[model samples]
Target: MVCRSVLLRSVAAAVLVASVSACSLWGGRAAKPVAAELGPNVAVLGVRQAWTARVGKIELPLELHVNGNVVTLASSDGVVAALDAKTGSDVWRAMLGEPLSTGPGSDGKTAAVVTRANALVALESGREKWRQQLPAQVFTPPLVAGGRVFVLSSDRSVAAYDGATGRRLWTQQRPGEPLVLRQAGVLLALGDTLVVGLSGRMVGMNPNTGVTQWELPLASPRGTNDVERLVELVGRVSRVGDSVCARAFQASVGCVNTARGAVAWTQVASGSEGIHGDDRAVFGTEGNGVVTAWSRVDGSRLWSMDRYKHRKLTAPLLLGRSIVFGDDSGTVHLVSRDDGAPLNRISTDGSGIAAAPAVASDTLVVVSRNGSVYGFRPD
Candidate 1:
């Protein structure tokens, strides 16, 4: 039950969470491994709090949408606001007056979010433009790109809608296991191709017509039961040119060459969070709070850091010379991008970080579970 509770706190949106045989997740409740002690804050990497804002508590997975210098974020209570990433000032805020499941994906102009009531609402400049009813529950943030709102529902269905009007464009459904992760799945635009994560495969689709272009499996289902075989790609992928590297739940991490529509490489990884990288290495956090860096060219281990083991870390953000991660203690960790060495740590509201840290216009922003939005700038 402790393992399940930790998972629930980390990925609160997980649906139909099945029973696990062992309590070995994140060090488990049996032994309860103690977290590593932090060293003195030497201020090796200079960072200062820029601004702070408030919103409703964010219990579900919320993917911060960055368009230019504006970042759009949503809380569980359906309070969607776009803030200037630099100053943490609100560009515009909208209250949907309903509980939201996921999102606040924006294209600098239009913002979109899905409510727990199965409604997709689009806002333009903080004004409600239109709202459309969805057939299935959605956990992935709607991709607002190219004048369209794309949604990947929990039932392994992909649908598109007009950004201006709530007109349905096309819906594509794929056969998948009945159990699906309610976390944010991969849904992004690769050039003109709509790269989506279906089950454990990264499928390329034509955004205009919703036609399948190419399909590459990153992981395959292999277990006795549905929960054991569950493999879905998470978000916050590392995209360098035509190559997009993503994680297949707790199975493996792989890169797909979108241009060639072929897999570059795949390495077995027991991490459940998404990955981030630049040109050299891809970085991810394992379930036990081990941070790993893998070579981007070939899926090989570059370095692994376990200093924060059992801390329940979120996915990382590759910012400048450091990779930033948030933990269950609401502390922001900055580690060396070249080596997984600790650099610095920043404290938050003590309510724990709700999601992965995001950066826009040189400003790093992290939202806490208590809905404290803090923006930091490198000094």
Candidate 2:
């Protein structure tokens, strides 16, 4: 069996265990490739670190919630904080006093997170609003929008709660592939439609009633074994108006016309992370750390860059004129979105970037694995 053992860890809800001698998750039996060497820092893009702050170590996949001038982020040890994007000053800070599995998803006013003990806790301004226990383990960050808290659990369940009172509004359970990924899944709001990723399909639901509106498959499961056939849609999708494009883990990348409930196009892409883009093109980092740009309209290859290959890169973030990516070496590379040319490189705390870089109020913020939050501004 490719998936030999299943262990529940603090980082992930469940981890896939494989053999060192057989085909592993990091591609095939080939040896790991060395990261590409970064040459001289051109620093053509004039940017400087604006400020820095500290939080608890971020071990889980916490989504940095950017709302206007404020960005809300959480640590694995249950420290949730809202920081001013420009000044890096704390707007408010709250400690949950436990290890969190995922979250700190906020809608500016209310923040939410899933604890390791399966409790969905909500906070307002810096105080606990309510806490509700979930039926299954949650890996995806709870979507706090439309005055409702939406959760996508590891067992492929979608539940909604009253954002204020933690009242159970409704729960929608769907049958899925036997094995669900322990990583963060897609749960976002597309106007009135509640967009969620269940297995390899993106399903649209009614936020008020939890009724299914439409479902579009991004990738089909293939291969003989369960591990080989895992095709779950990860988080951090690219949304351009009514069009949404996402990646089905290690399977394919596709765009969905949410307005029409139709697929624009899909191409086989061997990547595990989600994608980001503008109206013209979408960008993604492959499992080998090769960055790629695809035409948004037709899914054609726009360009590709291998300078960061094998570096274990996070998802690409299209910020202003530059495409931003955080690598395993605690380096944030700013490359040209048009051709992936080196623009600038910024160093973090040498503990690796914990999540994809986010921007708010013209300030770029990235969290390190050691809980250092660095904010940068264009100079």
Worst 10 residues of 1 by lDDT: 5-14
Cα displacement (Å) at residue 228, model 2? 0.7
Highest TM-score among the candidates is held by which one?
A: 2
- Those runs of model 1 whose alpha carbons end farther than 4 Å from true positions after fitting are 1-32
Model 1 per-residue lDDT tens digits across residues 284-361: 999888999999999899999898998888999999889999998999999999887778899999999988999988
lDDT scores of the candidates, listed in order: 0.87, 0.87
TM-score of each: 0.93, 0.94
